[model samples]
Target: MLSTALAAPAAAAAPRYQRYVALGDSYAAVGTLTKVRSAPIGCARATDNYPSGVAARLAPATFVDISCGGAETPDLTTPQEVPLGVNPAQFSALTPDTDLVTVSIGGNDVGFGEIVRKCAELSFGDPFGAPCRAHYTAGGTDVLAARIAELAPKITAVVDGITARSPNATVVVVGYLRILPPRWGCWPLVPFAIGDVAYFDGVQRSLNATIGGRAEAAGARFVNPGLTTGHDVCQLPGKKWVEGLVPTSLSMPVHPNARGQAHVAGLVAAALSQ
Candidate 1:
């Protein structure tokens, strides 16, 4: 009788994650990081993106990836109209049967691209001064910081909506990789004015903190890529996870490369296992 009871317990296995849906923006889609051989143009959904890596390791029964470049918080519910194609609402992929969902968004909504572009443009003239910082912080206001604060609620709403759609799914909100070094940045490689480098880094950190807090508040697990230590873009070739202003690989400047995506996948996998 004792043997029978023990065997029964052993025979009953833990449930596996059968369905997974990946949703988010350029970072999540791995835009310009690698080629999207099969995805529609402008979607930039790379085959080797973090989502794909996670799906491979988990080996889920169903995997749906709806991430696209330039997606904003609204794009999660509204169809995103791309230049050459239109992507369906990202949340449409989520169902009650979904066992897992992962998202990496909000950078576009907060104007990260514009900030980078403006910084790069200004850096050409003032390579040693904090020109980018001065531009955004003009009139005694940090516009980018204010934008991140405003987007916090939107992030929470997106998580809540995901939960409403897939009550039983384990949702993971992934944060961005570090792009700058701690003390100084690679001026020649990134071209951000010497003083503006730290300013940009601070902005990225604040954004990640906001994202992490919102994910926690909405009952979703947050996976920080933890790339701040030695994986910044300024690191040596093999050690760097993010690409510089002029990328060495196919990845876009200031975004994660293939190595960064793989590392983020590993972090997500670890979170799931726990």
Candidate 2:
């Protein structure tokens, strides 16, 4: 009777998720959207970000999001300048008692930003036959693949480092959301060379796989957003969760919109419940 009276509650049967720490790059920053955390310059963080949303839903816990725009794996491993703010890097915010950690990185490492810039640059003159799209569609660029492979070990190291710090924490690695669909629908605004959209998706997918594999190897759960495939940005408004090449509002083109962030928050929340 004494043991039964002292037994842990059902909610405490499994490790109760309490402290939440988020780490990653621009895509996860939730900047440029309303309620996002702002810095004096560079990429700003957002309170409406998925982590923020999840934190609100899972109240009564500490929430710390260290995500920034243009963040890289080395940013977590070493001390680097905070592009806009005073803080050094996102990892600096993490501690030994973190109950949860979410990460989505490596896109900037592959020069995805450059790709978008080039695409936008070329689209101005030749929307369809742009040299940037041409080079990418040629199927010879191993840059993205090579970059992701190199990052795999670094990401795994971060996971090990985190676990070393918080022996009882649950590390969650979030994958990239789909940018383009298997098929391109809109022209001009989202025009790309034949099959280029799929190619881009494949690269993003490969990069995400590397992140997931490494996270799993380090004993973390991998949360992939690819499950929202058909609902990628290219879809008609009200149907798409992620935004396409062009944003509906005056915001960053490639990053997630508020709706998208909400979806991500739900996913993260579900993972924590498990």
Candidate 3:
């Protein structure tokens, strides 16, 4: 009886993760400020991305990261072409033995890069008003909101696909960090007009909520970095996790910097511990 009880606690406490596979897009793979790693050159997969941090911290027996720049949900099932190389269908890394999976995607599906660029361009036209918001909300439609609603099911499909492929894995969906604050502040640095700042912020919040909802509904866990605000683009280099239109950090404009990746990894690690 003593042996059985002691072994039960030890077995229950044993590490469940061994083979770790990471899937997602730029946010998941590209720590724009960090040096490129073993992934394809075009992937721009950074050595310091959240997955790298997590792997280093957890010291998994095996690790595979197939994340890439500008990836979408379809990219998870189908190969994606990057600037100078092609990232294989992300799901190819999974197996029945895989025990850890992280997903950080869906921004590209909504044309997030283009939206930020457009909002910046529109801000130049009317930096005092909400020209960007007006442009997107034209014809009595909130275009960004519609895109998110349309994308909810597709995001859920990704969860289903991941679970089907890696049945034993503990899936963690890391939500995007904040970009702009809930109110307007930065002007020339980011170029978003006074009203457009909050407008885009709302769009991002909705997207994060969808990602979390899908992950939880599909029996996966979600970690929301957005909950800790003040790391948005408007903040200075040290304070901001995300860069602005003209990046102050080595990261790409509007993407997460090295600090941001570290923060995300910490959040994911905490979630895993729990």
Best by lDDT: 3
Better of 1 and 3 by TM-score: 3
Model 2 alpha-carbon drift over 4 Å, by segment: 1-15, 39-41, 79-84, 120-141
Between prediction 1 and prediction 2, the one with superior TM-score is: 1
Candidate 1 ranges with C-alpha deviation above 4 Å: 1-15, 31-34
TM-score of each: 0.91, 0.83, 0.93
Rank candidates by lDDT, best first: 3, 1, 2
Residue pairs that clash (backbone atoms under 3 angstroms), model 2: 36-46, 36-47, 37-45, 37-46
**Global lDDT of each candidate:** 0.86, 0.73, 0.88
Model 3 C-alpha lDDT per residue in residues 62-114, reported as the tens digit of each score:
98999998898999999998876789999999999999999998899888999
lDDT of 1: 0.86
Model 2 Cα lDDT, one tens digit per residue, 1-274: 5586568555544325568888888777863466656552455677777878777887736888778777877777665466555545667777777878888787777788887666656655655443554665466766656777788888788888788877777888888877778755354667554345665677778888888888898899988886567767677776666666777743467778777777888898898788
Q: Global CA lDDT of candidate 2, please?
A: 0.73
lDDT of 1 by residue, 11-109 (tens): 644347889999999788873444784445677788888999999898888989999888999999999988688989999999999989999999998
Among residues 3 or more apart in sequence or in different chains, the pairs in candidate 3 whose N, CA or C atoms overlap within 3 Å are none
